[model samples]
Target: MLIDPHLLAVFTVTTIVALVTPGPDMLFVLGCGVRGGARAGLLATVGVITGDALYIAAAAGGLAVLLTAFPVVFTALRIVGGAYLIYLGVQMIRNRKKGQTDDPAAGGMSGRRAFLNGMVSSMANPQTFTFMVAFLPQFIDPAAGPIWLQFLVLGAILIVLEFVADGTVGVLAGRIGGWLRARQAVRRRIDAATGSVFIALGIRLAAER
Candidate 1:
């Protein structure tokens, strides 16, 4: 077997719990859904999945360890990623204030832009790389047929779990957005709130070691 049955079961449970727990990824999806509608949120989820996939591959390929060995690179990623998030948040805030467009706050993004934004959010997410480096390996059994294969399997499982969990969040958040869209006062407040959340998330990510 590429992985031990017992270990695989435990990994599944642990990963489910991890994905269920509200993290940056989940929150990001929720915010996107609230702002961009269900489709936008799902696209963001896909982008996040893509980023996580890359990180998983990197972790399996020893990039995680190499990153650990070189603190400079990791630190650089943290700073850059954090800054990027902050930039996105600020732009959202500015766009809302400009009052120049008839588009809904969530309506402004095209699928391509949303997907790209999601990709950026996920890829640059400090937690993305760190989680891959810190987690998953613990379940790896050196005796397994091949470590890379095991990692790949585990990574696939994680992606599936995250999609289900985050997808639900996106869908539900879209509902909330639709409801809020009907009430101008509520919609305005929600728009501002979403932007604030993004800023807060960005700052939190930036400060995390």
Candidate 2:
């Protein structure tokens, strides 16, 4: 609330970009949506936001210093996260021959299970921690107000924006997936699309500095 106007604008723009960009979280949500349905997708979105909130608070509180002090730790975490993503992608791709036929009557995930999976997926990635530590403080105006409060305000904005953007993607992808599941050809392509997205995300994460 006490942020400078120009700084707030810049921060909003940057946050929007970050939210809209399809990262592992978004791709994961998309995959969930396609595989599980809209409800699962939305639940996953909630989970991702929860993780982002934790990282934001941690960064505001001083975890950022620890990250800065140990460069190797961050890099190691990134590599692990990247590899994990690739593993998931490869598993999905390899399982195609194992009868992944989509059932029109297929049930979606339960709320609790979906939320838990989403939370684990979001929190397991070290890249998320790195992103929070690196990105949130750039717009902090020490003179505007208590630093933590400012971070909370800004972080809240990010979470809300992300929920809207990611939520929409999840819902839409789920619906489209639902429609395509009834078609054999479309189902095959959907599976491939999902796996490719994950693989590409993993490669990008591994390559990032």
TM-score of each: 0.90, 0.81
Which runs of model 1 end up more than 4 angstroms from their true locations?
97-107
lDDT of each: 0.77, 0.75
lDDT value, candidate 1, whole model:
0.77
Residue-level lDDT of model 1, residues 1-209, one tens digit each, is 78888988998898888888998878888888887778877887888898889889988898888888997787777677778778777777776644434445533345566577667677667777767877788888888678888789999999998889888998799778867755556666666777787788778877887
Worst lDDT run of 10 residues, candidate 1, spans 99-108
The lowest-lDDT stretch of 10 consecutive residues in candidate 2 is: 100-109
* Top TM-score prediction, candidate number: 1
Which stretches of candidate 2 lie above 4 Å from their native place?
Answer: 97-102, 105-131
Clashes of each: 1, 0
